[model samples]
Target: MTDILPLAQLGRRIMVTGPTNAGKSTLTVALADKLGVPAYHVDLFRHLPHTDWEPRPTEDFHALHAAAIAEPEWVMDGNYSEILPQRLARATGIVVVDAPLLSRYVRYFKRTLQRQRVGALEGGKDSIKWDMIHWLWHTRGTAEAHRKLASETGLPAVFCRDQRDVAALCAAWDLRLSLS
Candidate 1:
């Protein structure tokens, strides 16, 4: 696996994957800022307003994703497994932000609370459904998924095993944010 920081410099199209609250958004935004690239967040499209995750139609989602990936330089972060191959085929670099399940639990709570303090989805309320946790529990650390992401992308892999891994990359690249 390669260090992620260098990938930011080399990759014109980047894909970042991880369970929610693993700093996927933060990294995507920061990398976009530093590199003067565009960040396409899948969640912003996956989730529809006020209907509780009423997913956009599959074709619609793919269309939107494809348009962004068609761009010569862009970054996207999310684990939309159904469209993994589409993303992988277009990715110039791939990153997986991994952490212990316990750590993910803690971060989820913290992030949920922070969202509550501020606001929820711009068009929806804060929702931390039991089903969401269940989904995370089942999906969070699937080795098969990671292997497939790496194998299909053919881009070198960068795995951030903990917060420190992300932090080190930020520091090394002189990024303005801290993983903390």
Candidate 2:
């Protein structure tokens, strides 16, 4: 099947996965709005809210992730590979946002400069860090892994190769985005 799936082909439980700064959260919110479902971010479950990006306990994160997936209809974003299998099993469809590594780096830098964004950690400040820069570089190939996972799982998936593709998909799906 083609990677660009029609809106009708997508089911209620949609999973959005991508590398850092790839706009997964933005698309997730947009999809949830279009589908009239709740939106969940894996990051929100991974880290404690109203904190300085501190991580929740591993067990706590797992519990939150599991509970969120148990919900019937939702758009969940993020690719915590450790819990991917569980999420994938519950997800009805997938959207993989893949952009060039350079673009991702640029976006990461730009996002850090912004005070607020769709995927920002709650009450956590955004700042440039060597670890994050290294992460963006190291996980450059995550998009391919996400695509392979979708194919192996036989889930209907829509792939966005760049910002242009994401824009086109949003347009085709008639998604009204809150943040550009």
Candidate 3:
């Protein structure tokens, strides 16, 4: 899954995806800030206002996302699941930030309490749902699922074990490129 690290060219369109609260947004923002690329958190256009997250219309959300990635450079993070194929076609690189289930659970709550200021979609409230939390672990990809993701993307995706792996990649970005 090292395909995500820059090779001959710096990626112009990058997709960051993982189970919920796996630091997808954090990494996307860091890369976007350093690379001067537009970053879109899929949840921003996905969830409804406040605590009720019924999600926006699929067609409308996909259209908006399509427009965002149509730019010369962009970073987007989320595991929309349904539209991954469409996203993969446009993604020059992909980062899959997978963390331990325990870690995710810990973060799930930390962020929940911080929701008043730091959690959830920027404009949306930090609403908690039992099912969503369950899905975070229960529905997350396994080894086979990950392999499928790699196959589907048809591109090497950098597999990050956790947040530290992400930070290391960002800090050693130039070194990785030189090796490539």
Candidate 4:
């Protein structure tokens, strides 16, 4: 008899949630690349046109997510509380990436710098300002709250405390698939 692998049994829908600059998008992209599935950034649905900070219609967000979930396989990344229930219902797995406040701050700063320097962000405009960074750190309380809610949801969640943990989880997933 041979042992079977767990990842071989994984379902298609997945959600990646985390604090700001915790690398949720990076993780989603990596997973999608590995799994050969589509990955959706919820921010793209939430952001309004020509405005970096302005939000789109909440109903539109819900509808967009609903449509995405209709797909057979997808990796959704974001921390939109209003759509949590719908996402949770459709997600086969949840990955929560967490890091210290200082670490998140550093990551956000570096990402902003990189995006600004590369002129790759929306509208070919750099929206990250010192005040925005300050506001991000100040408003981190919301991410913490979402983390708690996710924890309480009792989903089959993998919480990564830092980058090492994230790497380990990815390695484990790969190993399990290879063994299978």
TM-score of 1: 0.84
Which number leads on TM-score?
Answer: 2
Over 16-83, each residue of candidate 3 has an lDDT whose tens digit, in order, gives: 77777777777777767767778788887676556456688888888877787677788788877777
Q: How far is candidate 2 from the true structure (C-alpha RMSD, Å)?
A: 1.6
Between candidates 1 and 2, the TM-score winner = 2
Error of 4 at 57 (Å): 2.8
lDDT tens digits, residue span 6-87, model 2: 8877799999998888888889999998888999999999998777568899999999999999999999999888999899
Candidate with the greatest lDDT versus the true structure: 2
lDDT digits (tens) for residues 1-180 of candidate 1:
244446544478878787766677777877777778997788766766565456778788878888888899987888777877788788888777777777877766776655532112455655567876787688776644674666565676677777788778777767665342
Model 4 is weakest, by summed lDDT over 10 consecutive residues, at 1-10
Candidate 2: stretches off by over 4 Å = 1-3
Worst 10 residues of 2 by lDDT: 1-10
Model 4 per-residue lDDT tens digits across residues 69-114? 8888988888777787888888887777776778777766676656
Instruction: Judge candidate 4 at residue 128 and give its lDDT.
Output: 59
Model 2's alpha-carbon lDDT is: 0.85
Off by over 4 Å in 4: 1-6, 49-53, 116-124, 139-148, 175-180
Compared with the true structure, all predictions reach lDDT values of 0.70, 0.85, 0.68, 0.68
Using TM-score, rank the candidates from best to worst. 2, 1, 3, 4
True lDDT of residue 119, candidate 2 = 68
